[model samples]
Target: MATSKSVLFVCLGNICRSPIAEAVFRKQATDKGVANDWRIDSAATSTYEIGNPPDHRGLACMKRHAVPMRHVARQVTQDDFQSYDYMLCMDESNLSDLNKKASKVKNCKAKVELLGSYDPQKVLIIRDPYYGSDQDFETVYEQCVRCCNAFLEANS
Candidate 1:
C-alpha cells in the first residue's frame, strides 16, 4: 500500500476559500489516481463559523465545475499541527495565524505555508469571497485550480 499524505487547507472562516482549495486539490488528486494516498480536509483560523457549511457561493461554484465538496467549518487544532503533512493556508493573515497556532503546539511537524506559493502564475493570495458576488467565488475557483494543480504536481 502507498503511504498516506495529509493536507489541511485553512482560511479565515473555512466557509469560503479553504473549502474551495480542499475540493480542488481532492479532485485533482482523484483525477491523477492519487486520491487514495491523501487525507484532505479544511479548517478555519477562527471560531466565527465553526460548524457552519461552506458558503453558498463557494458551493455553487464547486458544483459548476463538478468538483465535489462537503465540509463543516472547523478551527485549527493542536492535533492538526502534529497530524497533517502540510497545512496550506490562503493569505498572509492565515499564514501568520497558523504559524502562531503551530508554535503553541507541543511538537508541530506539518509544513505550514501559503497555498498560493505553489501557483505558477505567482498569484500569491487567495482572497475570501464570503461577502462578495458569485464572480468572486469563480475567481477563487480559478486560483484554486491553478495552485492545487501545481501543488499536486510538485508533491507527486
Candidate 2:
C-alpha cells in the first residue's frame, strides 16, 4: 500500500483560489481512487475572512464544474508547517508569507511552493478573483483543475 501524503492549500484568503484548489485536488484524488491516501485542506496566510465559507463566485464556479467544496476560512498555523507534506500557496506573496511563518517553526516539514508550480500550462501564479467577475472565478477553477491533476500525477 502507498503511504498517505498531506497537503495544505493556502492563499491570501481562504475564500477563493485555495479553496478551489483544495476542492479540485480532493475530487481528483477521489476520482483516481486515492482519496483515502491523502489529507487535504486549505487556509489563509492572514486572518481575513476567518470562519467564512468560500466566496460566492467560487462556490458557484465549483458547482458549475461539478466539484464539491465546503470549508471555513482559517489562518495557517505553525503546527501546519510540521504536519502537511506540502504547503501549496496561490501566489508569490503567499509563498513569502508561508516561508516566513515556516521559518519560525522548528522541524517544519512542509515543502512550501506555489500551487501553480504544478501547472503543466506554465502558469506560475494563481491570481485571486475576489474583485473580478465570474469569468475570473472560472479561470481559477480551470487552473486548479490543470495544476491539481498534474500534482496528483507527480505525487502518485
Model 2 residue runs over 4 Å out of place are 1-3
Q: On residues 117-142, what C-alpha lDDT tens digit does candidate 1 reach at each position?
A: 99899999998887789999999999
lDDT of 1 at 54: 91
lDDT of 2 by residue, 1-156 (tens): 654899999999899999999999999999999999999999999997999999999999999989999999999998999999999999999999998898899999999999899999999998899999999999999999999999999999
lDDT of each: 0.93, 0.94
Q: lDDT score of model 1?
A: 0.93
- TM match of model 1 to true structure: 0.97
